[model samples]
Target: MTTKITWLGHSAFQVETAGKTILLDPFFTGNPAATVSADSVAADAILITHGHGDHIGDTVDIAKRTGALVVANFEIVTWLQGQGLENVHAMHIGGSHAFDFGTVKLTIAHHGSALPDNSYGGNPAGIILKTADGNIYFAGDTALFSDMQLIGDEDLEVAVLPIGDNFTMGPDDSVKATNFLSPRIVIPQHYNTWPLINQDTAAWETNINLQTSATPVVLQVGEHFDLS
Candidate 1:
C-alpha cells in the first residue's frame, strides 16, 4: 500500500501507512491554518521531534483524548507520563523501535528540546520511518549537517525538511541538504509561519530544482499526497 502524507502547516504533518495513522509535531490547536483542534484530531501514533511548545503543542491533550501512543526521547516520554499520558514510547538517537505501523529510527538533529516548563526534554532528533512502501525522513528543526548523507543512504523515497531560517536552515542550506540526502521527493516545511521564519517556498523550490535531482513538492496547508 502507498503512504499518504498531509501537511498541516508549520512542522505538523499526518502520515498514513499500513492502515495506521501517525502525527508529527502536531501544533495545530492555535495554528493560524489549523482546521481542527487537538481534541478533534485522532491518531494511532504521535511522534515528537522535541519538547518545545511549538513542537510538542497539544500532545498531552491529544494523547489523553485519543489514547494515541506518544513517541519521543526518553525524557519527553517521562514528562508526558508524568502528565498522565499512559501510552508513551521512548527512543534515543541512533536507536530503532518497532511499532504497530512500522520501524522508526531516530536520527541525530542539532537542536534543543527544553520543555515548556524549562525541563530537559532529551536530545533533539530526526525521524526515519520505514514502512512497507519505502523509507521517509522527517528532519526536525536543524541546521546544515554533512551526516545527512549517511542518514539518507537508505531506501528513501521522501524527505520532509525545514527551510525556514532563524530557527532552522535557510533556502540555500536546504537546497544543499536536498543534494546530500537525494531523496526521490522533497517537501519543505516550517516556513511562512511568522516573520522570523517567513520564506518564499516557491523560490526555494525553484532553486532546489536547479541544485538537485530530487523533485520538490510544496504542499498547501491541509493538502495531501500519496507517495508511489
Candidate 2:
C-alpha cells in the first residue's frame, strides 16, 4: 500500500496509510500557513506532540466534530477529555502502541509542554510511525538531541524535522539531525510561520543535501510526498 504524507504548514501533517488518516499537530485555526480548515478534514486519529497552543490548534473542535480519537501525552489527553472530547488515548514518551492504522512510538524531544488553557501538559515528544509502507519520524518542535541516533535504528523511510530557530533547532542543527537520523528522505517543518521563526528553507535544503546522505525534501504547504 502507498502512504501519503501531507504537510499542512507549520508542524501540522496529515498521514494516510493502511486505510487510516492520522493527523499530527493539526493546528489550523490561527495558523497563517494553514491550508485546510480544522473542521473540513477527515481523520481517524489525531496525534499531539505537545500541549502548546500552535501544536494543539483545533484538536478539541475537530475531535468533537469528527469523533476522531485523540492521542497525546497523559496530561494533554486528560485536558482534552475535560474539554468534552470523549475519545482519547494517553501515551507518554518511550511508550509504543498499536492501533488499526499502524504502530506508534513516542520518542524524547527537548521542548516545553504547556496547554493553551494553562493546563500542565506532559513532556513534548517526537512520534515514530511504523506502517506497511515504511517508518516515518515526526520530530515535533524540538532542539538537536543525541538520542536521534537511537531513533535511526528503526530504519526510517522519512523524517520530518523542525528548522525554525527561535523555538526549535536552526538550519545547522536540523542538518545535524538529518545526519543522525539518516533516513532515506528528510522533510523540513516548523519554519516560516512568522518573522521570529522564519527560515530560508531552500538554503537549509541545500545544506542538508551537501552534508547528509538523505535527500532533503522541502515541501510547500499542503504538498504531498508518497512512499509506495
Candidate 3:
C-alpha cells in the first residue's frame, strides 16, 4: 500500500491510503493560496488539529456536503454538534481511534484553540496516522519540543512540520525537530500563505538536510507526493 499525500497549501493536506481519503486541517474556502475549492474536496474523514479559523476552515460546510466524519477534540465536536453535524468523533490528546482505513492518534501540541465562535476549543493536538504504507506524523501548528524524540519511536516514514515563523516554529527550531524525530522524510508547511508567515522553504530545507539525517521534500501548492 502507498499513501498519497497532497499539499493544499499552508497546513492543509489530503491523504489517501487504504482506499480512504482523509483531509487534515482543510482550510481552503478563504485560503488565498488554495488550489482546490471546498466544493471539490471529497473526504472519508476530516481530521482537525485545532479550532482556529484557518485550521477549521470549511469543516462544517464540507461535512454537511460530503457527510464525512469530523474527527476532532471535545470542544470542536461539541461546537460542530451545535451546528447540527451528527457525524463527529470527539477525542482528546493521547487518544487513538480506528477507522476503516487505519488508526489515528492525537498527540500533544502547544497552541491555543478557540472556535470560530470564540468558544473554548480544548487542547490543540498533532495527529499520528498509522496505515499500511507507513506511519505519518502531522505536527499541526506546533513548536519544537523534546518529546518529539518519543514520537520518533513509531518508526515514522514522514514528518510534516511547520517551518513558518511568528505563529509556529521557525526554520531553526523546525530543523531541531527534524533531528529529534529523525524520520526518513520531512515536509515543510504552514508558510507563505500570509505575509506574517512568509518563509523560504529552500533555505529551510538546506538547514534541515545539513543538520539531520532526514531528507526534506518540499512540495508546491496542490502538488502530491507518494510515500514508499
C-alpha lDDT values of all predictions: 0.90, 0.93, 0.92
Where model 3 places Cα greater than 4 Å from the true spot, the runs are none
**What's the TM for model 2?**
0.98
Q: What is the TM-score of candidate 3? A: 0.98
TM-score-sorted candidate list, best first: 2, 3, 1
lDDT of 2 at 61: 91
Write model 3 residue lDDT over 1-228, tens digit each, in one string: 689999999899999999989999999988998999999999999999999999999899999999999999998999999998999999998889998878999999988899998999999999999988899999998888999999988899999999888989999999999888889999999999989999988899888888899999999998988986
Query: What is the lDDT for 9 in model 3?
Result: 91
User: lDDT value for candidate 3?
Assistant: 0.92
Error of 3 at 135 (Å): 0.6
Candidate 1: give the clashing pairs.
none
Q: Per-residue lDDT for 1-228 in model 2, tens only?
A: 899999999999999999999999999999999979997999999999999999999999999889999999899999998899989999999999999999989999999999997878989999999999999999999999999999999999999999989899999999999999989999999999988989888888789889999998989998999988
Q: For model 3, state the Cα shift of residue 145 in Å.
A: 1.1
lDDT of 3 at 135: 92
TM-scores for all predictions: 0.98, 0.98, 0.98
